[model samples]
Target chain A: MSASDYESASKGASSDVATFDDEEKGLFGRFHHALHATPALVPLIVLMVAIGIFAIVLGERFFSPGTLTLILQQVQIVGILALAQSLIILTAGIDLSVGAMAVFSSVIMGQFTFRYGLPPAVAVAAGLAIGTGIGAISGWLVSKVKLPPFIVTLGMWQIVLAANYLYSQNETIRSQDIRDEAALLQFMGIRFELGGAIITMGVVTMVVMVIVLAYMLRSTAWGRHVYAVGDDPEAAELAGVNRHRTIMSVYMLAGFICGIAGWIMIGRFGSVSPSASTGVVGNIQSITAVVIGGISLFGGRGSIWGAFFGALIVGVFELGLRMAGANAQWTYLLIGALIIGAVAVDQWIRKVTA
Target chain B: MSTEPILKARNLVKRYGKVVALNRCDFDLYPGEVLAVIGDNGAGKSTLIKALSGAIQPDAGEIWLEGKPIQLPSPIEARRHGIETVYQTLAMSPALSIADNMFMGREIRKPGWRGKLLKQLDRKEMERLARDKLNDLGLMTIQNINQAVETLSGGQRQGVAVARAAAFGSKVIILDEPTAALGVKESRKVLDLIQDVRSRGIPIILISHNMPHVFEVADRIHVHRLGSRLCVIDPKSHNMSDAVAYMTGAKEPDQHLETA
Candidate 1:
């Protein structure tokens, strides 16, 4: 529009548009500014408030180290998956195959150790590679082939799920066999009592991941590129960012993280089963966490820590409701309301124009 | 005014299906001058600049930068050759802070081990440079350098975009209607900005529909017509009506200033 023949654009910047500062004068306005400054704060606050309510109602028993650590352990799998999901969603893309990829990767690790007689560590490495390879395929399709991530990952989810059953023959590597031979495969399940709380290796891994990814997103050039590509690919391209490379790496990195989750999934479940339907259920669980975490599905708007808080929020709700003798269905009802409320708040925060 | 042209385009031709966007169009930009490109809707000014900025490749043409023929297959390639373009969209990430947007692709890294091994960004230095550039452009009203671009007013955003171009556009800067999305006061600031950038000795190619703005900042006006350059008129010699008449074909130059 360098040589716009009509004076169409100048008409937009009138007195009304210039009056953006006028509206930012009250409590709601301050909240809007705070949310705009750090979107993840909303999920963090929600998680704390939920915990406070549960702690007050259930007394110190509910807030004890044992119960708190149990919450971390329960959320380990979904927390890791949501980390991967958060990266994909921040780029305005969704990875429907995330769950299938993790499950399929676990199946590969278990089968390779048994079928090929490879070292347990080697088998674990193979699983991570397969996970990353699956991500690369999805990334290639989305970044280079320009396919919509939704469709690509949806098709990938089906393909990977079917491949899991076919390749693993729906076999279940029992906990007994794994514990006997592949003690290394269950390394993430190794637990220790720290100050009367049982902390699993899987929880440690998730916390470390959240910290590293959060730092990378805030302090690295690559992280900035991810947000830029997600925010506006064309803009990033014109600004000299290799948009395709950025997106391709994001998917690959998400895949690598998912691969790690798969390894941890073994630790969490203590078994590698091709028919573990819980892995399939992980897809929706991660998305729910991300939405409630205040990460805009539109992309490039939330913190990775928000996803961690999001997963914790769900874990807290489930445990709190159960301890209060509430029905399991009540958890769903409340989470559904939170999802809607989160999106509504996101929209409100977005309306803040300085 | 008699020095060699800094940027020259010769016999450029571009077509989209049956539509001829630029037919035998020619352009020349001298150093340290604001060259205003004025034309009607279909006069091919947009296409002409796109070809020059490497947004679209002309079917047949030779773009000479500093008297050397260069091929710009992509905008990145054009930027590498020290030609920066501030597009109509401003090409900025809205969620990013002003400092991040300023140093989008060419971010500075911390010195020493952390820089080499961990690849840490020099956020402090980048923010400082960004603030300096904005300050140089008299855009210091922005309170926080860390504020996201989306929070800034439209005029302030434009100021940032222009400042970015001026800071890094070493050879030439192409501004696509920089003031079109701004109010009267904002447009006035941008006009001042164009003059300020020109004062720093970098040539600019400004395309605008505002004839008064065109006349105000322009040293030479390139009037585009029928998908090509009609003539280059001195803004000092011609008024707004004359430029409009030349562009709309109501009148033509007595003799076309075809070449620089």
Candidate 2:
């Protein structure tokens, strides 16, 4: 059915429900009783349509396996990182330290593996610990100290940026001593051939992570807590939800994911450079992907899949600009315009719907 | 009805610095009855509700549930005792479906990740329960509980909130200004819902400024004046003017038998 038709039906059903007696209410009441029951099929459908349009425009080049694989590789780190930001945004909070945190943790990993001669697994763990520890501190400030997440994370962003610089001493780690794991980096970079389409391993991992996170947000009890805290903390508390614990958990989860993204970035670039990925593409792309995916910045209104689709939208837009021969500076300008446009449209839609 | 009061508050006091919001107030909620709290703005009506709901800790007070003294440290603690509150904003997410909002923070989950994917939210069960809850209060024309809350009219939204509290097994439902933003028809809908809740044996505390509503559903009208519950009068015995005069402290309570 059409969108308006479905809405009208819902409205009629709600009115009819007002006068019905308890025992008489039946099957219609069973399968579709949630207030947020409007399925997000529309956004998913729109994403697919956008992909089709891009494919048609890029023609043979976009349809090629090599190009598809390249896009996946290009977006892997930020795609996963954006998923992290989506969780924070879902709770009506922001983590400005995400990019810097990723860089800082990767620096730790570099130190562990290259400078201190630690195992890869140990280095990975060290990176995750650093990232998650910072996240815990930030979460504490937000929940316990009652600081705003935006300000807390913004300050952390600066701290982490400075720490990363100090930790690196303005030098790039170029040690080739760990040559035994060259294949490991290739493993992260490798692609599998399926039905004439090449999808990188990182792409598969990111897709799975996105689906899992989305499912967790939609189907789990913890997911409900996240939405509840975002919707109204006082009411959620009255309903027996642990608002502080959920908020902290969301921040910690975001940190853990960024940690993983850090390792993935190191693998992709073959080295860690302090200046190379500082604030990495401005974090604008990550935010853009999330908003474009249909997740509201206001929280309690979007999904993790929206973050995934948002990333693809960013990927497509970047590819489109390249195909159109736009200058390097225009890429940032385009993304900036898109972010503003998407947010404005979202506000407009909410007003109309409300 | 049990002999013991389901909920009680004594010597409840709250001060916002120097401003006394609630002063030495005492209140009780019995099983299977509707209690109407009437007062002008700044009469500490909201403050009393907040204290009862565990939104804030009272400076000096004791609460009891089922005859045992209790401490309402936070709202979560209040819900553990089966108290739910429907606020002025309805405490619902407009972007979500009605059933989702009703069952939020207490969602019915499947067994595992696989179950979550295959069985999902037991959506059918939640919807059935939601419908039954709504129907219990004579609110059953609603065909799709999956619809977003943004689509519903004001009365419908209020009704849905009442239904939500009922569905959650709230033994005492405190409604704060449920009809303030509504029109005449909508207000009547909410009043009927309160009565329906009372009929179901759940005590309801209806906080309203509308006297007609007070007389319509309230078994007892408790008037708050100058930071205290001046007096409680049976609706059947007191007229609107008598209640108002007492509420504003314009007329002293008449107790001919006592000398103070």
Candidate 3:
């Protein structure tokens, strides 16, 4: 076979796949394609339906602006934490230390302000630095030390939890004291009325975090690298992506976000307490939001907006159930079903490898 | 043919836990030539490819690219010097869009303040380039440019992978078992793709065990036996049996055939 023969024989020989990209037929295929295109849709639809159901059942009680705005306020902290978790999860890694890291940073802020007599702003900065530095340690362990992310963050969870207890000596910083001395500590508690809903600054912060992080993940090279690294680390490496640097940077950025979550913790509770439920309930709840929101647990195949919608779904369930006079515990049972259902649907959608 | 080799390897020795995988193996790839490396399983052919592609560091070897000795300690480093490899797995991120997979590591940023200050990706430009490259291979039949790679058939995925290598691989392109898992029709497409790449004047190092495919497409075949290059035989002058015999240690290559 001469080179000229190859050219003659090769002409017009396209092995184009016949079934490629034919508009998926039938409801199942169309739904799969739809879910594939917009991962956040599942949670969004679930959220809308849950709200509609409660509005019909509870009438004016559920449809009121107070109840609706309160749901957003309640999920705001978890929403911020989910943003941090989504960053790690997108890399196919989980950060079990999110709540512990946030609470620990808040404790550090209190100590810096009261014990050291530092200004509230300076103390808050120190807290942010500590949170980021601790996250960097976890990143170093995962990237350089070659440790599994789950194990590194699991061990970090315990260590940071213990440190929070020891450092704060179980002291609670009162809201009055924060108001008199370090007013900046309670900054996110400030509220304003908007379109019939009373919106807290904390809710605004969470919304801003989601919008900004979503933009970063969608529009930047670093964002693409995150998906690549999560989708297939080995493949990403072969394509010239610095896997270590990317992983390290993700952990560090997650940590910085967790730090802000800590600052907002103070505003949400009106006090700095080591025993805040953010540390205890935050880890599981944020993960719950991420899962229900439609982000795959396996990594690299979800949207950050899915997580926000996920948190909103839980919020709707909680507020709706309470208004309907049903046990709030029913919210857990339904959410448990949603998480498993989301994963199953994700698996089904993932089979579109035609 | 030019006197200088475009890519050259000498005395590449790699040992894994007291087992010598590549024992002083030598290889040469000339400019614009299809150099097929044929060997039995465990003949160190893959180890040789890995060393050349920088997938693994050779304990001792000198790799010369266009007459300059270079150290290839990693796959990323090899790609830096215009050496692209399409692995047996195709090494693609299946969930990403076609343009995203092609520009996985090197993404073009948007222009002006949005790009310079915000570090935003210029997705439109990348999609245009990806479409152009695929079209160059006459593979523009697939309509959607943003469709995920997983949705494409096996042949189309391999086509995208090949187009990617041809687009960015400024010097050498290596394809490992490109048609191993393909049907006859798909294999024909890949064979055509190889010839097309060679027609574009880029040298290719094809690693395969299939004799017919190798003989049909390769200009020169390098036989590997006992962890080293037995000889380099010209496919134009030799037949399949002689090449297989040399590789399996049943026949010794003549001195004239060795230097071709």
DockQ of each: 0.44, 0.33, 0.48
In model 3, state the lDDT of residue A342. Answer: 84
Return the candidate ranking by lDDT, descending. 1, 3, 2
Better of 2 and 3 by TM-score: 3
Which candidate should be chosen as best, given lDDT against the real structure? 1
lDDT of each residue in A52-167, candidate 1, tens digit only: 99999999879999999999999998899999999999999998988888899889889999999999999999999999999999999999999999999999999999999999
Worst 10 contiguous positions by lDDT, candidate 2 chain A = A30-39
True contacts kept of each: 0.67, 0.42, 0.62
- Residue-wise lDDT of candidate 3 within A143-198, one digit each (tens)? 89989999999999989989999989999999889989898998888888877788
What's the lDDT for residue B240 in model 3?
89
Query: What CAPRI grade goes to candidate 3?
Result: acceptable
In order, the Cα lDDT scores of the candidates are: 0.90, 0.75, 0.89
User: Which candidate do you rate higher for DockQ, 2 or 3?
Assistant: 3
Task: For candidate 1, give the DockQ.
Answer: 0.44
Q: Estimated TM-score per prediction? A: 0.93, 0.87, 0.95
**Superposed model 1: Cα runs more than 4 Å off:** A1-28
Clashing pairs in 1: A2-B176
